[model samples]
Target: MLPKFPMSRQCPYHPPAGYAALKKEGPLARVRLYDGRTAWAVTGYAETRQLLVDPRLSSDRSRPDFPVLVPRMAAAKLVALVGMDPPEHDVQRRMLIPSFTVKRVNSLRPAIRRIVVERIEALLDGGRREADLVPEFALPVPSTVICELLGVPYGDHEFFEEQTRRMLMATSTADEAAAAGGALNRYFDELIETKLAEPGEGLLDELIVDRLGPGELTRLELASIAMFLLVAGHETTANMIGLSVLTLLEHPEQLARLRADERVAAGAVEELLRFLSVADELQRVAAADIEIGGQVIRAGDAVYLPNAAANRAPEVFPEPDTLDVGRGTRHHLAFGYGIHQCIGQNLARAELEIALYELAVRLPGLRLAEPVEQLGTKPGGSVQGILRLPVVW
Candidate 1:
């Protein structure tokens, strides 16, 4: 029998040894990481890949057997993606896919670069000699880039940034996170109203005002979609920005090489993304009893695919733990796999590439201003990232 792990544990991210332990233990094992809930953690690369693609795994939280990882209210706020089974998830996903395709994202490159350059300039002019890169550079650049892409007013950027931070803080009280989420929904509602009045050329406006008729996306659903874009797009890229810089700074030789060879920078970003595997884990409920990798999971059971653990699997990646930029690690699950793969991946790549390329070129002498251990990661960011990256160029 597998060992029983309980849900009364601390944050999953705090357990650094858990991945190593899981690897030693077995492919499929029970975990108690959620708030007193029993869940399965699947570690083998092939197993995780298979599970992610399988229709038997469900993302719906409304089911009677929903496996919750947080307080009810907070969990609801986090899993707001149209949780319907395949066809519905397929429809909503398809609707948003066009906005994040390679071509569409590439089209946004010039605008993204402009945003990066503008932010860097402002940082430099506004006393960037010593600045918290997360707030001053990493956070806002993507927040605004996504905002502009979605047609949210630049003025509301402040509101989105603040509430997003509150919602992600691991220590946030249930009420506090819920309040932040509500504030975001209210802001999006008003923004939706404005867009309906005078539809802007932005994507959100286009989706709401153009795609949907009178009552298509209910207020909650529309707000949820908007919230998804804002938080996911914002936190993921921001963390990459902060973490990539820190990684490059720590390995001066790699940083120097990247600076010397612009061609290699893109590869460096991919490798760093693979190495960091910023997203912690993914949650799914077993739609029905299914067997995989020689294990049986019953219906209503929660399964966690630790993409981080899979990324480090020796079978898929040789010397998986090492951060080698030239290894050609293209299939990393950093953006996830199969149907639920991140829709904003192309946009994220554009943003990371631009940020790394520009920062290397602009801040040639940049280095971490504090001890490595002193730097902190955001406590509760669904998309894991640095809390503050202090640097001086």
Candidate 2:
């Protein structure tokens, strides 16, 4: 019997129960997708890493054969770097690399620290004994930071946030997703034109005055990149912040360890990332016939690399089920691997470290207001994360 693709997880902190059987079957196995299409699902640590970096694989979503995990994803266009293959991918990535360098990300540290403090203060000022951390703190820090970075007006965040939420939700219909995408594209079109006329002090302005003026990039291309940054920049890290707090609270010992010694905060972030590989699957299509681990992925075949399973592979992480804040998790695929790895990873790491550290210091008595199983999770999507994390201190 063929396994089903995009299996649902029994718990947010772990992969779907079916993943164990799939891993036991082998590194690569055939699975049926939601659309009744058969594709290869790579479930092993080594195979996932190998194929992610393999030139024979393609990230172009424009390909007719590319795997569609959800109905909405099928309507997606290949305008952003995540969907573009190299040469074009290389050129586009290089243009934004300077903004995310270690030094550049570090320069933003003061601002990120300030955001965290202000959010925490607001939560305290409310004087509420119990609150949902998602909207109260987790979502705001990253949203504000991305708004500042992109020169997007924070007052307009509600519009883009609603559109992006609709676009990412698995329950959203193809038409709904397309409508959301269209709204974002049109919004950016107007914003890009404004930036061109009166360049501001944000990244969009830099790209306009430097890259666009030089004719190195088209207005549409610049707009697409801005849209990509706006969505990808906040969504992933915001989810991480909420989930990380919940995970640490669940394991009081680990939380206490972090609170006691702030020095281990960095290591704690890596462990949290490995433990909760939020992106359940990475989609790719074979550009050419490729053979690995006694399986042949023919040219034009769809491939699904489930990093959640790979991160838990026992061969790489002994007793992978347990959460250890001091564990060496540098090799985890949480940020992906190879050329398509997350471009904003440095910025993400900084935000997480500061946010988690502040939470530990300010809310020493923090605990879950509801049972772990009762917490709300975003349903039927590639990104696995909590919709609301209620807590009290």
What is the clash count for each candidate, in the order shown? 2, 0
The reply for model 1, stretches above 4 Å from the true place, is 1-15, 72-84, 126-128, 214-216
Writing each residue's lDDT as its tens digit, candidate 1 over 1-393 gives 343332111222222455666667678877774356678888888898889889999887677676655542343523445355677678678778888889998888899999999888987896558778988988888989988888877787888888876776655667888888888889888888887787788778767864566666676677788888888888778888888888878777777877887788678877877777777667788988999877899998888876777887888789876667667668888888888888888898889888887888888878888886677655422556666788887
Q: What is the C-alpha lDDT of each candidate?
A: 0.75, 0.88
The residue pairs found clashing in candidate 2 are none
* lDDT of residue 209 for candidate 1: 67
Worst 10 residues of 2 by lDDT: 375-384
Candidate 2 wrongly placed segments (more than 4 Å): none
All models, RMSD in angstroms? 3.0, 1.1
- The lDDT, on a scale of 0 to 1, for candidate 2 is 0.88
TM-score of each: 0.91, 0.98
Give residue 30's lDDT in candidate 1 (0 to 100).
Answer: 76
